[model samples]
Target chain A: MKTYLPPKSTLIVWQIRVTVLLALLVAVLYWFIADYFLVLFCVSLVLAVVFNLIYFPAFLRCYSISVNQNAIIIKSGVFIKHERILPFPRMIYAEKQQTLVAKAFSVSALVLRVARAATLTVELKDNDIAEIMKAVAKWQ
Target chain B: MAVKLKITAHPIMIFYYLKPFWFVLIIPLIKAIVSAVIKAEVNNVLLNELFISVVLITYSVIKWKKLKINISSDFIEIYLGVVRRRYANIPINKISTIETTKSPLDYIFGTQKVKINTEAGKQGSADFWFKLNVGDVKKVTELYPEKVTPKTIKFSAVRVAVMAATSSSAFTGIVLVVPIINQAVRLLGTAVTDLLLDRINKIGQLFSKFMPPVVNTVTVVFLISYFIAFLISFFKSVNFKVVFAGKKTGVFSGLLVLRKVLFNTKSVNSVCIEQTPLMRFFARYLLRVGIGGYGNRKGDRAVVVPSAKRDEVHELFSVLFPKFEPADNKIKPHKNTRWRFYYLPTLFLAVSVILYLVLSYSFPVFKGLISFGFIVTACVLAYYYSLAEYNTKHSCISVAPVIYANYTRWSATREMFCEHNRIGIIHITRWPVDKRKNTCNVRLTVRSEAAESITVKHISYNELTDEIKSLYQI
Candidate 1:
């Protein structure tokens, strides 16, 4: 059995993206709302950014993929720990998609899909994806 | 023998090609005609509409001319698009369902609109849709050599009507009319809408004068919507018939616009027997099958029996899907966890009490009505919870080496029977509280039009593991 975790570089890319989005939202809200409540809004924005930064690392720590000879088990979810078992024989398709930020960090989202609409999507580095794909091909 | 034929759809395809722009075409034409009759002259808007209409018609003609189907021995190729040409080649054996239907125009012209579907295509839509002449439809059917005379089952008009009424909801009916109502309001202006509102208010006044004050305009509107939904469903389900031919099954339905769908029985994933709250009152169940390329969307279920008794459903199951017949062995939930059923209703009651107190404090004007509504809702939910608990006690999961069957009753009772191959993924969820109890929730998903899941809650951890291991041999 092999366990794979997402690389640390993805976290930096995610934080940067979230920060930029938050900055844009703050700018928009600033123009519309009253000046009296600006201080409160700024404080709330700071807290939101702080919370987001902390959440990514905790989430990355919790998420993991374990591949065995016959099946792959994925552990995810932030508050309620979710474990999904995907057997190689039942899997029909595997798709790899990369967002702009993920591409820059050499990370991609791998979607392991069974029949119909049941799919498990996870982010992993290119090397990890190749290894998982190889295991999937060997088993299936 | 090798077969090769090149053909085009019926010329009536042009009507469907222009269906998307119906409002654009009709609105301008009506305006022009009315203006000409009233003012004795056509304006710039009429000329602009004429130009646009000509361009749209020309485009449709070119598209119809370009669309061609090439049928070979092994595959069917479709050449599509006028501006940028592209063709799709589908192997004959890979096709799952060949659905034939007729719109009003197609019926008039003796043409059938055919949809070729495959399991591998996108969900909720057919892979290919085109029109074919009656003779061409017969020719297409000839591509499959195997033939057998099928046994037919027909539904009675009364049963169909009852089933339609039970299955229909006010939301669906409102969805159908909301867009048309919006269009009417936009075109007719505010004076017409105000007059309509006045008439509705007058009706509401009469209702308040005679019946209870609760039966207001809103309730009347809801009842009207529900009736419309029932009518739509009734029309769609009229003349519903099911045919079983060895390894194939065919469904024929629709009143004005006739439809015929043929699919292989081997491809069927799950056979579901369901009863909504309303159906429960009549002691009836709606039996449907889940196939790869059919019933992917809401209201499109491949119904085997619309409204039938328990024995009738079981009898039909033996003939229609003998492989997925209900099993006898049952696995009940852990008895200690039965209290979980009352958890939801308790929560609702608690929320209702909190809301009543808060509203009474904030809004003294509407206190009496708010309290009455909340109490009624909470009571109904509690009663429903009791019913669900009783039903769940009777429900159980039946599993053999190669087949899995689940029976569950909540707001609706759903029983699903399927073979092992249809099972896609199994998820075992265990929380902190569940771990303490040494039990877990096992959710089993099946391969169908949509990923339908059957969840067995509060089952012993070791028992579930053993059952899964024996079933899947993992």
Candidate 2:
């Protein structure tokens, strides 16, 4: 089995956009409070570099996700690598969360709660959730 | 638990009598007498004494009017207060513990206080200390047993009897001796007063007139306090009794005004045998029960055990809770964090003391020495406690999906039971040093009695990983 992008990419994007907006607003507020807040422009650049350090590779790995017949495994965590496996039969519920920005971006969530209560979530197009949910149900 | 088995918790009748009644009244009266003597006024002495007596008598009468208690097989009910009568009726099933307390004071007066607590709700018990008129506690404990007390309970009755007699002697002697100590202290005060006669006379004059013989004021307020304390003590001692009355499966026990309480051996989560440093030196121990709920979680003062001798432990426990074994071997926890040398509790104290001495002008030498001594003592004590904890901890799986972690730290062992299903999430944090050592720490999130998630620490990195996978069956 191959795990696709999460069915809630649009929702995740909306959340990220909102977060970014909040950060920008805070930066503006800091600028109003202290003139030296402009130095944080450099800090944000450094932060963006740090984010991409993990996120870029993780995104690539996520696209290439594959697993055995029983489970779809996602390998992550740099120092303590975790191989999270979601067994199809143990999948109890699945959902997609979408925010306005994510809807505009056409991204949604493919969220699944396994019998063990471990949450397996992947960001993807909203269309992927129903298909994935149906396929997992049929497989189970 | 037979249908015919009737039980009762005797009413605490002593609340009607003045508590340390005379001890409370006498101090102000004495101060007034002393003032009157110094001033050479016989009328003032007589007036103060009469005023103190009136207050004591009025209090005793009010209490006598307020207290009423009764019990049947199903319930133990109490109606208290002459003014705003407060009523409480506890069903027999709600009773969680029946404790009989005897102080040195209780033994001297030939009385014991019976405290009965029930598990009606999560916060389901109150201690009602009553001087038992008769001494059969077995009759009281039989009312509520997790099961009936089994007759097979091992008893060191000989040892228990000896200890009980010895303990009982000291309390009475102490009460009787209190007068001697009071007089001696008073004599010392008198000598000091004479030496500082001119100054003390002026001070006494200012204090004497202000001491209106009201029930709650005056520097001699402490006098009435002790009088009340003495009365409580005498009442607790008079009919002091605790019996190791063994029933079919549990032990039934209480002092004079009988109370039958039942505790299930299996139901108890942990038992804490404790003492302050002072009590530890005296070899005195207090046993406390810690169950799974939050209601009984935090308390330092517990019901006084009839005796502290180790030999009588079994007999007492048998009557209280038989399923619980004093030497339970099933669950013991391993010491993962034992490097006290790495922990800077002692160093911090020493450094702070040194800093205070160097920077502060007030009694610097005394503070330094005291702080240094305390730090050294605490370091040594903690090292020992950590070692003991290591030896006594072990974990076992008795109930499915529920693991019990038994820990003995600070001479008090507590067992924590956590269900695998109850774990919300696991967080593994690695400090810079830990990362170098490849030993990460695990935090398990559990919903405690308050229903909010509580994160518990100190599980090994490898063990946490193993537990995670084990919880999920393929």
Best by TM-score: 1
Q: How would you encode candidate 2's per-residue C-alpha lDDT over B271-349 as one tens digit per residue? A: 4343333333345544444432213333211232433644444355444654443333232123544342235545655
**Candidate 1 docking quality: incorrect, acceptable, medium or high:** incorrect
Query: Which number leads on DockQ?
Result: 1
Model 1 Cα lDDT, one tens digit per residue, B164-280: 866666443454344444433333333333444567977545544444333344445665877777787888888999988888788888998888988878668788888776677
User: What residue pairs clash in candidate 1, if any at all?
Assistant: none
lDDT of model 1 at position B146: 60
Which ranges of candidate 1 are over 4 A from the true structure? A1-140, B25-56, B72-74, B142-146, B170-215, B326-329, B350-368, B399-403, B407-410
